[model samples]
Target: MAKTQLNVRVDEDTARAARERALERGMSVNRYIEELVRQDTGEAGHTFVEAAADFMKQYESVFAEEFGAAHEGRGEGSREHRNEGRR
Candidate 1:
């Protein structure tokens, strides 16, 4: 893949922090920024729907458990009783 240069301006403190973080991570500042952008843009490149689906799949069990707990003991037909021919 071809790489392009991007010049951005930041406050002195932010630049210093970025440099320190990059050094701590053993990456050049450019690579650090690239990684930040990659994460912000999402891995596997820009497919938000795929990412959302993966997120849902990952948390589906948790969601189901919470939902079941919330609805537990409501009894069957509780919802229908509430509606009661209101259509």
Candidate 2:
């Protein structure tokens, strides 16, 4: 499925906590945050990942059409070309 990027800002303390908790779970910060969001919005026996896959399967072409060909055939999310925001 095509993947996109999301960036968020938080205070240092919040960032530290996310780092520590992600470390405790032995997962990348990205996957850890994904798990947290999954738990928050998920129903028992159904995961956010499953729902996401289903949605993507159903609407991926629509997204590619709406967003443009640049959004097509994308793999994992990338930050390689991002412009840094001002502090």
Candidate 3:
């Protein structure tokens, strides 16, 4: 994609908040703002939930065969269960 530079102005408090948010995400303020715009405009790519569902659907049988015993009684929501480790 072709990149273009945009100049924006905001109050000091807003700029500081942007910087803090960007820092927390380990991204530069420019990239953080870019992502915010993408999400707001619904141009963002597939979300983690969508991707994770796809992955679980693809490997569900394999996981069942291997980990079925361990997952016994945990119910059918293994997808949510598997995501616990990420947190």
* Cα-based lDDT for every prediction: 0.87, 0.77, 0.89
TM-score of 2: 0.49
List pairs with backbone clashes in candidate 3: none
- 34-72 in candidate 3: lDDT tens per residue? 999988876675575688899999999999987887777
Clashes of 3: 0
Model 2 ranges off by over 4 Å: 48-87
Query: Which of candidates 2 and 3 reaches a greater TM-score?
Result: 3
| Worst window of 10 by summed lDDT in candidate 2 | 78-87
Ranking by lDDT: 3, 1, 2
Per-residue lDDT of model 2, residues 1-87, tens digit only: 576799999899999999999999999888888778867776423865678889999999898788766654343443432333322
Per TM-score, the best of the predicted structures is: 3
Tens-digit lDDT track for model 1 on 1-87?
899988999999999999999999999999999889888878635666788889989999999898877777576657966787687
What range of 10 consecutive residues in model 1 has the weakest lDDT sum? 40-49
Better of 2 and 3 by lDDT: 3
Could you tell me the TM-score of candidate 3? 0.54
Count of backbone clashes, every candidate in sequence = 0, 0, 0
